[model samples]
Target chain A: MSVFITAFRAFGSQVNIWLDTATPAADGAPVLRQVPGWLADIEAALSRFRPDSELSRLNRRPREWADASETMLSSLDAALRAARITGGRVTPLVLRALVAAGYDRSFEEVARAGEAGDHATPVPASRWEAIQLDRAAGRVWLPDAIDLGGTAKGWAAQQIAQRLAAHGPALVDLGGDIVAQGKPWTVHVFDPFQPETPFAVVALHDRAIATSGTDYRRWGADRHHIIDPHTGAPARTDVVSATVIHPDAVLAEALAKAVVLQGSIAGLDWLAQHERAAGLVFDRIGRVLATENFQAYLTQTQTHTQKGA
Target chain B: MKMTSTKRFAVRTALVTSTTLATVIGAQALASIDEAARAQPIPAPTIAPADPVLQPTTATGQPVSAAVPNVVILRHAGEVSAPAINVEPQAPARPSASVVSGSAAPILPPNPVQIAPPAPVVQQVAAQPAPVTRSSR
Candidate 1:
């Protein structure tokens, strides 16, 4: 099979689209061309960094029902569903907490300003249940501000991959939340400390993979983007990163973050409670811990590496 | 069991009077409980409004009330069957002992490229930036 690959920056991380087909020029090019535009539209609607975006407008509006676009409504629905399934371990209502944690600006701006080692007090808790959605009217009511964050990327990846699958086998990677359909594609779980080597490689088909880590997007000591709702602060856990594989990219993203917050052992156990979900966690000490069935998806070489290790 | 008519009438009157008095007392007690309950303040609801003004539409464009309930519960198809097992914590491998191919090279080229697979190339993982050399912290 011939593979056509494209990469660009979107959603604060690199996005890569891979289409496998018999004819790259004939089949892949058309489908691939539309992806960037689609991503731009999604980013425009869901980006919290953009003051004029739909999300920002919703956040700024008073706590009352206001008109929203279909994209905004659906993204909010996905975020709520994630919160429901994870029991608020993963929530979109972390905007205030995120800002309080010194992520008031875009990661790019934060990094460029050398804002590391600065910390802020934890913010008060926000509830996802307070956000109300009227799907028919295309209206939404926010109890407070929210940040779609990685959830938007995962949802967008799934949507784009589903659209591209009509033509041929496809994989959409929006900054690490990946969705693949039609055929099996090999995915490598990168070691957080050592990005050069993969701790595990697995084959996925009609599935999604997501990794959440504190190693990136760090602006302060012990401060990261993944916030625990209970504490309303950057999560403090022994696990440095958590990678989850599931049928939905959105859920995978949520579960991965939830796992990191819960730490390795409890995180893996919590991940096991979800049907068709598997996780691999990297602790602060560089030791790898994976769910039992995680090995089922491992490629032969990765299994060999496991045995040798 | 048999009694004179006057005696039977007297007994019946006494039973009727007691039953009426008991009923009156029971009714008064129930009324007082109802008043007490009404006087108590109702707690504020923790959830959204029971009847959300925004409703989901059907495919036929008809408004379907109660279609979107106040609380949405996500339902998965299958039961969670797998129990979490603790895998032995694998130590970092030696530099020369890395088994995966294309370890040093990046996954995507600067420009779009088409290639046939057999060689393992690193694809970007979710929520992480592209693997690049970074300055020491």
Candidate 2:
């Protein structure tokens, strides 16, 4: 069987699509024509870019008992778990702040929300308690515009992976919120400052990797979208970038945020609790602080890019 | 009654066929390792690249290391993907390194050797070797 691989950069990053199919399809075929029609299904289910997406509907719904799909509901649950685990360091509640900070519109709109005076503080991070879900009725109510952008990406990646389960060997990188299934694939981690070079090239076969850093997409030299729920402002710490790996992408995404906000020791402690979660953190210093399990990931995907990425 | 030569030939063919099937089945087990090796994301770099070195440990809790030099992500070997771009490795010591607290920090008297501020040398923390494959097993 011939291998199928497709990659495209969207949502401000890159995504790699791979598969060892029974036979390869034409490259020009519309994304819809692909064997795994599941991609479209997922794009429809969670795309924040598409105007009619489920998330968009929820975002626009003006108070008529709106229904959330199983995907969103499941994600909410995961976000809640991560929030509890990290003691609220990570949360979906940063939505109000995100919008006020200028991400209220499309990602581009937010990008235009010029990095300004210290971000506007909102009522202490939207409390998850304010949101209500009627499990039996499949309904959700957000007292405030409690945003889920934090956990949605991770949720979407997981959903996409589940949709492609029957497919053979695959990797999905939704703007760096990556999730892989089955056989492993090579991934290169780069130094954000030196986009031209790669720091390490790792072989990841089955786990989800989500990186949280303040490089290009930041509000200012000191601000980025990765908001700190506790302070209602940009998160500050010595760790410049944090990559979290876990069987659960939702936790990984949320945890990455939590760790970057909490700093090193506490972040490692949270990372240690999950048997499947380990991480690598890079500081202002040119050193590598790896969790007990991070070294193994580097060994399997042993290729390193010549330049610092 | 004497058995004919053709009858003996039929028995031999049956034995041969049975043996061939066994060989194929046994070979399947041996191929699993190759399958695993091929299925894995093997290191592609012929020469190890520069490691993400850490700056010396500091008072505030910050990471001291820059990049993990050896980590092998594997099946069932924990999480493998990263959250964002790895930070550029700076030639400074990791503020949170063990050398600062793990009895590795060279002990100094209350007022000890203070060489006129060693001209801005990039102090980096060394990386330990632990490849990803070791943990998967």
On lDDT, the candidate that comes out on top is 1
Model 1 accuracy (lDDT, Cα) = 0.68
Model number with the top DockQ: 1
Tell me, per candidate, how large a share of the native contacts it keeps: 0.00, 0.00
DockQ of each model against the real complex?
0.01, 0.01
**What ranges in model 1 sit over 4 Å off?**
A116-119, A301-309, B1-137
RMSD of 1: 16.7
Q: Write the per-residue lDDT of candidate 2 for residues A1-309, one digit (tens) a residue.
A: 444545443333334455444444533223313423454565565555577878667767634567887766776677677778777877767766765554555544444444333445544586665566676788777655455666766777677676556655556666567777787666666543333334555667778887775443454445566678766766776555677877787777777777778765556655766688877665444334556566666632322222223
**lDDT at A41 for candidate 1?**
95
> What TM-score would candidate 1 get against the native?
0.68
Residue A90 in model 2: shift from native, Å? 2.0
lDDT tens string, model 1, A181-209?
88887776665554544545577889888
DockQ score of candidate 1?
A: 0.01
| Cα deviation of A110, candidate 1, in Å | 1.4
True contacts kept of 2: 0.00
